[model samples]
Target chain A: MKKYLMKGNEAIAEAAIQAGCRFYFGYPITPSTEIIEYMARKMQQVGGTFLQAESEIAAIYMVFGASGSGKRVMTASSSTGISLKQEGLSFLAANELPAVIVNIMRTGPGLGGLGATQADYFQATKGGGHGDYRLIVLAPNSVQEMTDLIMDGFDLADIYRNPVMILADGILGQMMEPVIFKEPEKIEIDKSWATTGANGRKRNIITSYNLHNEAGEEKALYLEQKYKGIKEQEQRWEEYHMEDAEYVFVAYGTSARIVKGAVDQLRKEGNKVGLIRPITLWPFPEKAFIPLLNRIKGYMVVEMSAGQMVEDVKLNVNGAAPVAFYSRQGGITPQPEEIIEKFNNSYHKGGEQ
Target chain B: MGETIFSKTKGLTNTPFHYCPGCTHGIIHRILAEVLEELAILQDTIGVAPVGCAGFIEKYINVDFQGGAHGRAPAVATGIKRALPDKVVFTYQGDGDMASIGTAEAIHAAARGEKFTTIFVNNGIYGMTGGQMAPTSLIGQKTSTSPYGRDSSQSGYPLDFPLLISQIPGAAYVASVSVDTPQNVIKAKKAIKKAFEIQMKGIGFTMVSVLSTCPTNWGMSPIQSIKWLQENMKNYYKLGELKTPEMLNQ
Candidate 1:
């Protein structure tokens, strides 16, 4: 367990190598390009694959091809590039291909600038592509966690035989922090369900083409059952000083880090503040937030996007407390001090509900 | 490795291939199989077949076959090759799959010099989708899509795939050959073999364009289909090596 100072992107690539990922296909995009570059340099050393695909579309399909062959495969892209990958992602999900997709998110309705933002929350957590499928979304708030979760993402992907996304932000990708790169535990490769080019036994076919209506419906139902099981097994969250606190700040990823710092400072100032950091965005810890709702006085939903996760929080809270949102758009990361100020402002002003 | 490799391509199980009588897909498929045999890499090879008439090539090829989206065989091949460099990878694509819908995928694969071979079949018309005008359709070639004969004022002239591929620095070997005659077919087989050899040496992207016969679209007999390919298509798409690995290293 040697600790190495690494940027979030580099840590993820290193973690992937440790996790037995031998295939990486990606196209360079802002913020996330470093992830691809890191893998590109490291893959050669490990006899792994590194391909800079023509586009995000091409890159993801390569992910499809490799993953279908029962290999640990992955691809990374930013917001706009990820948007282009929606169709392929849906196909991957529908086919139940075990692969990882890292989205170092940036702001975008279209091509948003290269800055940190959590604008992809809905897209990541709520089936970004046109399909009734849920990708296991892991939100990492630190470089250390980013590395750890990338390994976990691969395991989860293999376990569920589905795509797992590390819905990270540009801040996380660029920021450098000390990380202990642990040698990954040995895991057996499973290809019982994979389409490894039809080697005699039952002709392994990997496809999402369910032309029969009944067959498609049945597959969709089975996927729903898997999602339900995942919801029970994989929901994760962190509670910061919520035991006796009134105002609970809800956030995740970089926003959670900012909100955590804010809560730490506000608690010292004698204001009752706490943070709820969601690690798994898809199986959002709605139940964990339930115990806090009755104890908390007010809710400040701090995010880099405009009220996306805030809506989810409000819906979960269900009027247990009034919810206030503090957000910034187009790649701006909300500062710790700024988030603290919002918390203080709302706490002092009293109820507007 | 010394064992002769049989042709991997076959007609669909329980159904004959939908190709026109004497369509060159069967010929090109055999050439690819022959090359894979000569290289002794068929057992470890993965072939990506693109959408079009040849989209169901996965059914035909006995080796590991993965179907790719139209024009995306190259990209799919890139992935499979990159993931498993020890395994030989190739793509069998039709003109529509190689030229029109997938130009970007093809160009980028070549530009990146991905270590894979692409066997491109050009028959001047889209055979799968009821004989539509394809990218390689000659100027004024009539099809369902270009019923009035392709008017250059509206439709672009036929694309020269070998000429285009030659410009790509990443490409180690590029040649255009025809399956219209026995001699030309033999030459085509040699070209396919050479392309695979370049990939085996890690010589980057290799592509061979086979001018094929499409009797149903050309409205010709099997013999006339061959004759038409020789007379008209061959003149437009001359059979020769556009780029060789030796030329590239120099």
Candidate 2:
């Protein structure tokens, strides 16, 4: 294994190549441009293809086409660029294609500046595109995790025959950290369904629901079964100081890293504050809340956005324990003291339900 | 044994076409499938079907096919051809799909010299979505959207797509032909075959536009629709091989 100090965006490119991805199509946007540039430079040396598409819509459809051709393909974009990609994403999902997409998120309802924010939790975890589909969204808190999860993303996409998204933030995208590359586990996926050509056997037709197509209802039912299997199988998270705690802070990605600072300082001051860092944002690791709900006093959801993940926390927690939310907006990270103050202001001390 | 004079090409599946009666799209599809079978690239070909009346092309085509978003068939074809360079790839698009909504995808694919063939069908009206004004609709044509007949100032003149594509330096072959009569259908088939042949030789983008008819949308009988395309559309969009690889060599 070789170690290199690389930006989060650049690490994503290198990791995807190591995972046997040979096709990349993308349009440049801030916090995600390095991913494309890195791919362009490395793809040439790796006997791969890299194309800067005319638009985000073109890039994703190219991904759709390439994936159908039995190749591991990828595309990266920011919040606004990802918005432009929604139509193709819907098509990718409807067609049940496997491709890795990255959204190095920037703050936005629309063009929310070139700064880091976790405002896209709803878009990433819930459905951004118009359809009843779920993207296996992985939120990486550090550059190392970002590199490792991208490799995992490709495998999961191929296994499930669905799209996987790396829901990263601009801060981690631009930050530099040392990452060690490891050999990827070889996974043999049955690509007999791909649209290579009709050389020997019967032809393969890749399509979705159409007006004349009468099998759309059955297709939707089949997809629901696959989603149900995924939810039961993949739920990932990290619990810090969770063995003995009264109040838990639920966060993910950059927001979780910030919340960790508060967890440590609050523990030094004799406060039982813990952290639950969700990795798989779509599956959401609701099981992490179950064991803590009986003994814990309450839960506090910390985020860089207003209050998105908190609702999910409350939904899972039910009425067992109260849930409080704390946040900063517009590319702001609330300090540890501020997080502690919000915690103190919201809930009382002493591990009591 | 009796000698058969005519048979459906093996390049198409047993699935029947869903196009309306008196529409020339059926003729164009048969011509393309015949070309694919004649070239013996049917098994190696991958087609990207455009959104429109051609959206169900996958059901009818025998070779591998991928459905495309509206106006994005060329881009989809680009992806397939680049991924598997040895495989033959093509796109089938309508005037509303290629000339109007998908102009950027079509033009950029040609500009980038993507190695693929495109079958462009020009019916002078939007057929699938009911009779509406298209980019190829004539200056005075009365469509559903253009009820008062198209005013050049309001709806703009018919866009000549092959002429526009031929001007691009990356395009190696472009032809505007028609299937109005039996003789012209043969000529149109020849043009389609040439376009696919150019793609096999690793030439840049190649396209053949077949002037077609839609009697249902044009509010005319099938014979009148053919006459209208020959008299009105033939004058607006000239017929010929607008560009060829030989011309590019020159």
Each model's backbone clash number: 0, 0
- Residue pairs with backbone atoms closer than 3 Å in model 1 (clashes): none
Worst 10 residues of 1 chain B by lDDT: B7-16
Model 2, B1-250: lDDT tens digits are 8999989899778988888788988898888999999999888999999988888988887899998689988888888988999999999999999999999989989999899999999998998889999999999899999999999999778999999999998899999999988999999999999999999999899999999999999999999999998889999997899999998878
What does the lDDT read for residue B34 in candidate 2? 92
Runs with alpha carbons beyond 4 Å of true place in candidate 1: A192-203, A209-215, A245-247, A265-273, A290-298, A318-321, A335-353, B1-15, B18-27, B30-42, B127-133, B142-149, B181-190, B213-231, B244-250
Top model number, TM-score: 2
Off by more than 4 A, model 2: A212-214, A349-353
Taken over the whole model, the C-alpha lDDT of each candidate is 0.83, 0.90
lDDT tens digits, residues A1-353, model 1? 68899999989998999999999999998888888998889999998888777788899889988887779998899988999888788878887888999999987888778888988999988988887999999999999999889999999999888899999988899999999876666667577765444445544445454347999889989999999999999999988988788888889988888788888888898988778888999888887887776677788898898779988899898999888889887877788888776766676866332
For residues B101-160, write the lDDT of model 1, one tens digit per residue.
Answer: 889989999998989889988998889878999989998888998999999899878889
How well does candidate 1 score on lDDT at residue B90?
Answer: 85
